[model samples]
Target: MAGKRSGSPDPKRHLWVLGLIAPMSALLPSQLVLYTKLEVFWWIGPIIVLIVIPVLDWVVGEDGTNPRDEDYELLSKDRYYRWCTYMFLPVQLSGLIIAAYMWSGDALSVVDKLGLAATLGFVSGIGINAAHELGHRVEHLERWLSKIALAQSAYGHFFVEHNKGHHARVATPEDPASARMGESLWEFLPRSVIGGFRSAIHIERERLKRKGHRWFSVHNHILQAWAMTAVLFGALLAIYGLRILPYLVLQAVIGAALLETVNYVEHYGLLRRRRPNGGWARCSPRDSWNSDRLVTNIFLFHLQRHSDHHANPGRRYQTLRTSEEAPQLPAGYATMIVLALFPPLWRIIMDPRLLEHYAGDVSQANIQPRKRERILAAYEYRAAA
Candidate 1:
């Protein structure tokens, strides 16, 4: 069923190397601070993610070009693409280790240390994106690497919850990661974190039960994943002393918050309709909100091609296509992340978009249960009008 790519060879084949920017951005600040003796450079990681990338996205604009269907096989098989992500692990670990050293030392003031922690948090958050790409792969090494990447944020459960839980129930009321119509980022974050954690445990426990494995057995994937985090954090604490604990915790919280913020953006208010048999409809390209801005595509490894991803969950990052049916985001994830922090601003921008996506049907969206009456009152009139 694959069609040949009629155009010249993939234009972006070599450009995939630029994916290194996310991991390298963390280390760039350290080198700048080293040479210039300015602590301000410690803030570069967040600045690059929050400011520079969004600016680049605006300037460079969206790239709707998809790798031709015929090329998906060749492109996904390329070892070079695999290495681009594999190389991220070293740079990411290096950034965290370097941050631990700096956080433990007395040379930097509290403000400077906090800035560095924020930088590392963004790095860790972006590392989660790397883990996401890797975690979805069927390869054992890549799956293990996914857990290692998640170790930085102490969010090892995501490896299970995402591939198992989210991809199953996305765009539905049952999915905690799927933000409802009226849910703000603040309200959604805690629900997602706690709910996802519980879901991961439940998933793992069910798997273990089927295999006749005890709850405490080595076969527990969640325990195996969390063990890596324990060893990673323990090693850092052992080397850096206790002074770095607060910053360690701070960066982890920031990293987790960043990941959850992106989750809130991915499927905000989208819903899968129930079928005649009371089953949910299959997730289609239209279920996930997608963006294809070139910069964020490279940075997040085509994660914004999300609708295709949910549709073809096994597809590699480089080969994920933009879908015509997917509801498009006004801006890339970086810009949207900042907007999501403010509830009113988020509703002002996304509420109408959500309504519009469902053809002005307020009943079609996955709305927050507590706010459903108010949301209907607010938007149903507009829908009818």
Candidate 2:
């Protein structure tokens, strides 16, 4: 497929979108409170969002732009995304505060309270999400915001690894973060989490060696991240006491799970074939997922524009555009994540398409497969290799 042509970004549109961040962040705690109180309503948020949003988008349909313009330049060094990053600090902090309150109140049931805390924790993932965008930038303020965002999630090394490692080597077997074709979500999660962290350590170590410093020193982001996580956990313990420790851990786990779920969806079944020279093709927007669903796009700060992100890592979230040349998920990211929870269904739905796409390229002789068995065999060989 041909790549989509996008128009230059519009700053006004970016500001309009950035305006929504505060309200969304503010509303999340209240929504969690309601969910905790009602108990039954917890499922409602995911249901309504996962099901209804896509149906509505399908009915309304997207503008038929080959590569939909995201207007990334609008926020690309502009103050709008910076302002959003600044605004996000309070929003995430409020979530931590609310978790503390719930832990202290002792009025709510364990499940309900944990649910609320988990929701907030998931919201905290937005910190990493935002950082994922800003860390790619060259500016000092943006880089700082990126670190702050990652620090908030207790996943600070991602700021270094994602830009230095993942982007540089995505869609290749060498990249621990990339999901291989036909790999189940269950299989990918542990590998990605463990491998991603190790990659970060490796990247930081290389940087330290280059600078003639010890890898374990304060300058290393991995050690810094551990210290930051310790401080966060200490604060949680202080505010909520021992009773809330498990809940906080669970909340972080759930948030991490949510992040992994997103990773699964973003690059599920995508692959970069090896060239004759033993190098994978250069990463393209086509190697990642793409969605134009406006609602979740707004909530994710346009992260659904995965192709644009891979193509231009330094671009602010406000500007990530949609590209037609990129492979698209059949539905919005939220819905796709829900589907990914079912491994059989996910494989059945995705494997055939991937096989077809990979095999269709005649120029890529190594990717050719005469039949489905051949495709499966090829993957199995690669996995073992």
Candidate 3:
């Protein structure tokens, strides 16, 4: 979740209504892909994942507009969007089970095994996306479902860190989930993963302390989710044996990586200003980049509209709107993620925008500490010249 918005709307059923179908696309092929040879089936999910979705993201352009304020009120009560996420639980679990069955029992080459593992990872990542939506609500059922989905990726503690720590600290220097100005994806990955875990523990500890509970107890939110993950994976290991272990780990890593990539993209190089009162400025659309590309918007539950999601963290994704003030991404999450892997290319595309975002005032930006002096000198000098 990333930026700002004001309510607006159109009465005509907007295309975003179709967003419900997007997550299911990941599940639709589970059975069909299994019917093909391991070589062909293994590649099917990834192709639809890494290639087709991005292409659709490009062709469909963007819908920067939001539903009318009245429409939003109506949309919020519409059970369709909420139920869509609920439906995600079954498809995600079934897809994983079927993919594992095919991989474990069906004789396959090492290449196919890895490829199938990746395919399952793609679905698991999509499941996490759904869980993210569910996890944000105050409702008990939504929280439970969100944790269950997280179990598939073995990244359940994300539910706690994200809602508690990330939301409060996002776009600030202190937020590990927010990528630093000059930090490469390679550098951000390990930091975000390890630091986020630690942050979750810290946040959960503070929360329990407020409630008069000890941090070390299994009752801590982080441990509760992690225990769920353990039980889920333990059951898999018990039944599937050693061969399935690698498949599980590979998929889980990719799923978690998917989450990190989004976090990296969501707030890359953006920072909230520090107040004289020692508080960070309130988050605005300008503090986050946004992409309203049609395909990724729906596919990710309007998460590409990072600005609105951050501005209204509790706003249902269906009603999340975009503001013109946010930094616009050059492409959707799928494309940006690929670019992120190559730092030089990403820097070329993003660094100038980062400078431009701060109106060329390097000091206005929250920069990477190690290179802060070098960056400030170069960019600040360029602006002066």
Candidate 4:
């Protein structure tokens, strides 16, 4: 075991969190039950991850405290924290391979197969989250492992765009990752999916061009990730046959959607005011939706404390601290993601929060231009009355 940071929480205090890692590795065993004639708990993956985890989050509640400022350097530098994420790479890989194997065998029901895909997708989605934390490091190996993890989502460009493109332009109209006020998730999905990929490519090409390298050069990060994904999926197809294609593509879509949903939530309706010089305000803790929900933070490497992530992009996840000044999410990411699927409820719940954050001034909110008039009319009219 790596030495604990001075004044760190007792190992006994948070040992339970270590158990949260099981689902990614457990998918095979759960699905294996479906393959057996004597049926057992085959639907465990989604149930544990989606249903049970939320209940646990509600029960365990939030932890708002930060590591002692003096301890941050030692804590963040702890190799033990990094190893937990490194171990997940194989866990994600094995889960997908077993999922493809199960999907090829035709033993599980359609619902279970979809359940299986969604389950793996969500788990693998966390791999991207892991990659996000690892990608931000100054370490070369960690950054490369970050890209390797992202290949599971087929969103390899994220390591490039999120760091170079999204961070620089976040909470502005020009940033595709920031969801405008009054934009539905359904609407934001296609726009984000397409625009995000294009943004990544644009950022990468500009970077390479600056370095005097052609866009088509072997050094392209997007090509590197895509090439690995192609070889991976090609191998899966050859081994598992055509059935794995739908499974592969569906899981990838679900994984990417998981990420976009986070992007949608993190800064929905938030704006960084433009300076007189035409530059946007420096990204701040106030610009993102933050949650101190303990369980989700433990599972996602403290990504729920996103306010700090945007403000301090180089900070490791374990040290992400909460601030009362930052806007709060209504719930953890899983519950919020479920809520975001319904446009009506999502607006009813989130719009008021956005309005409150801006003190009822809709003009300050990042309203989707298409819905700008209606949204402003509704809120502005209410504020006047």
Q: For this target, which candidate reaches the highest TM-score against the unseen true structure? A: 1
Question: What TM-score do all the candidates reach, one by one?
Answer: 0.95, 0.82, 0.90, 0.91
TM-score-superior candidate, 1 or 4: 1
Candidate RMSDs in Å, in order, are 2.7, 5.4, 4.6, 3.3
Q: Which window of ten consecutive residues has the lowest lDDT sum in model 1?
A: 1-10
lDDT of each: 0.90, 0.65, 0.79, 0.80
Ranking by lDDT: 1, 4, 3, 2
Clashing pairs in 2: 9-71, 72-319
Best by lDDT: 1
lDDT tens string, model 2, 58-123? 675543232224433333556855676667766666656666666667677776666665555556
Clashes of each: 0, 2, 8, 0
Q: List the residue pairs that clash in candidate 3.
A: 2-310, 3-306, 3-307, 4-285, 8-67, 8-68, 9-67, 9-68
lDDT of 4 by residue, 1-385 (tens): 2345433542323542463474364455564564775333445555665677678889988888776677678777777788877877888888888888888986777776776777777766777898898889999899889988888788899988899989998999988999999999999989888888899999899989989999888989889888878888888899999977876887788788888998998899999988999889999998999987777777787889999999999887777788877999888887788788899999999998998998878788888987777887886553223
**How many clashing pairs in candidate 3?**
8
TM-score of 1: 0.95
**Residue 270's lDDT in candidate 3:** 92
Candidate 4 local lDDT, residue 62:
83
